[model samples]
Target: MQEYADPVIDWLDGGRGYFAKKLYRESCALQPNGSYTKDLSLVEEDLSRVCFMDNSPVSYNWNKANALPIEGWTSDPNDEALLDALPILDSLRFTSDVRKVLGIRGF
Candidate 1:
């Protein structure tokens, strides 16, 4: 049997277990009716910083692959796991509760 490391498991092991919160915060920040401006790049940069804070290698790989590090998982176009995660990925958006939990300055 071919062994494929589960991305989710790898992500958790990478010490970015709270990536979901980051993702939600970014989503909220980028929302049209949200507090922050609609600059996706700024949010992406922050998200990248979160990954870099956890593991340099993962951050390098993520940037090299030109993939968005969403919810601790690299959104690689060639990765089947990423493709499978797309559906539920949208559900990771930020809500008022999530903003409060993350202590996001802006709603």
Candidate 2:
């Protein structure tokens, strides 16, 4: 994690772990067409078991079926996007194939 993520993290319980290494990847599709996305393949994790959440839908361009959309955070005290996503994520924990679930949800 970078210095930008430090302050907010210090407020949550065990927040540092949430920002642990391998939690994210760099942009792989930065082009004139404006698809600034991250390729999940770079993470080397099993796609079947992986579900990605991002505020920007384009980040899911490469593997959209596995995408989980969340609202962008702006340090708003009233933000509840993460809370809204918890149930879906909780169900994902027991999924054998994340794509199937996300696909059914129309992601």
Candidate 3:
């Protein structure tokens, strides 16, 4: 689970970084342990992060459009080759958001 959780954290942080830099569509990735049977709290936290709303450095989220230039690792770590891992993240993020907004409650 940590393997998945760690990557999710990195992706969230990266997406938040991009969003902060005003790179909207560029910021997206998948969450680990995301499913109909997963923990609701974790899922909510993950969604909030992708939406650029989470504030914790451990999490990640949107903040001020057009942030300053970054120094490293903007490229997708999951695949510096294909960049196809991002949409999975985006979909998971959106799913969590929809579930929360719709008051779907727990798994």
Candidate 4:
């Protein structure tokens, strides 16, 4: 938790978590009767503003991989406890998916 403080500090001090308020404004501008041109411009403006202030640019590379060995392990799961927890984790995932399908509010 101590490691998480700097970003929190940066956020509260003159940062664009402040400008996230503009997301609502920009969203409103996209309404049917709003200026279509200005709406689009505000959308892009908010997006760039967010990316700039947050330093998370639009581009990213994603990847997937198969197996990886742990420091002193021979195979996946590594121990009995991880193997035991797998089914519980899978059940929680299924429950989450079911909640999503049912339009559960706080998911």
Candidate 5:
């Protein structure tokens, strides 16, 4: 998963390192017993400060209030999903708790 995500993340940000952390199936988010279920609390102690984006709802099962669900990216030239989300992402950075905005927006 890390190998697959690295290129996609690079392409999205042009290797500028926009993402502070990258967690995958093999990351600390995984259960200590080696289960696949993710509990993001392991990766970030403060759920209020995190906004996890995933195409799969199951991925954010443990933290639905803090999720920012996005459609899976295809190579669609007309795709503007990310573009549409920029304003929210940008504004949330200035807020005290991201979950407050996410919840209010019904994300």
Candidate 6:
């Protein structure tokens, strides 16, 4: 569980960080154990350090166009490679977001 903490925190602090917030709410619903509860709080703090909305003009234009930037998007290849090595993180983030939306409407 401790070994899972850092990856979870990083995923929560990534592009789809909002999924972490939704996961936290769901975990709280499950009545998790002490260690899991502690991890959640720590991840929450990490999430706080992440900026969800990009206020830049480029970001605004991209949002309006419903497209993502292809160039100069990633600054760290090593970090990108590291994330690529952990494939489950992407699934986890997506699943959490879907779960959150479904949970909201009692689906």
lDDT of 1 by residue, 21-80 (tens): 332223323334333322323335543232221122233332332233333335455656
In model 1, state the lDDT of residue 105.
Answer: 23
Cα shift from native, residue 39, model 1 (Å) = 14
**Candidate 2 vs candidate 5: which has greater TM-score?**
5
- Among all candidates shown, the one with the greatest TM-score: 5
- C-alpha TM-scores of all predictions: 0.21, 0.73, 0.24, 0.18, 0.74, 0.19
lDDT of 3 by residue, 1-107 (tens): 34433464566576555333322222333346331122223333443443322222222323222111122244455543214434533454555344343233221
What would the per-residue lDDT of candidate 2 be over residues 40-95, giving only the tens digit for each residue?
Answer: 87664678877777777877788898899877788799998877877887787688
Ranking of all candidate structures by their lDDT, best first: 5, 2, 1, 3, 6, 4
The parts of candidate 3 lying over 4 Å away from their true place are 15-36, 41-82, 88-107
10 residues in a row with least lDDT, candidate 6: 62-71
By the TM-score metric, which is better: model 2 or model 3? 2
Model 3's alpha-carbon lDDT is: 0.34
Residue lDDT tens for model 5, 1-107 = 57756776677677776666778886535556544555777666887778877777777877898888888777798988777877888778789898998887886
- The window of 10 residues in a row where model 3 has the poorest summed lDDT is 63-72
Candidate 5 clashing pairs, residues 3+ apart or interchain: none
- Top candidate on lDDT is 5
All models, RMSD in angstroms: 15.1, 3.6, 14.1, 18.8, 3.6, 15.5
Query: Taking the tens digit of each residue's C-alpha lDDT, what string does model 4 give over 1-107?
Result: 12332444354445544333332222332335432112323434322222111111111101001111112223344455434433533443354232232232221
Give the Å shift of residue 44 in candidate 6: 2.3
How many pairs of residues collide in each model?
A: 0, 0, 4, 0, 0, 0
Candidate 6 structure lDDT = 0.33
lDDT, model 1, position 33? 39
Q: Rank the models by TM-score, top first.
A: 5, 2, 3, 1, 6, 4
Candidate 4, poorest ten consecutive residues by summed lDDT:
59-68
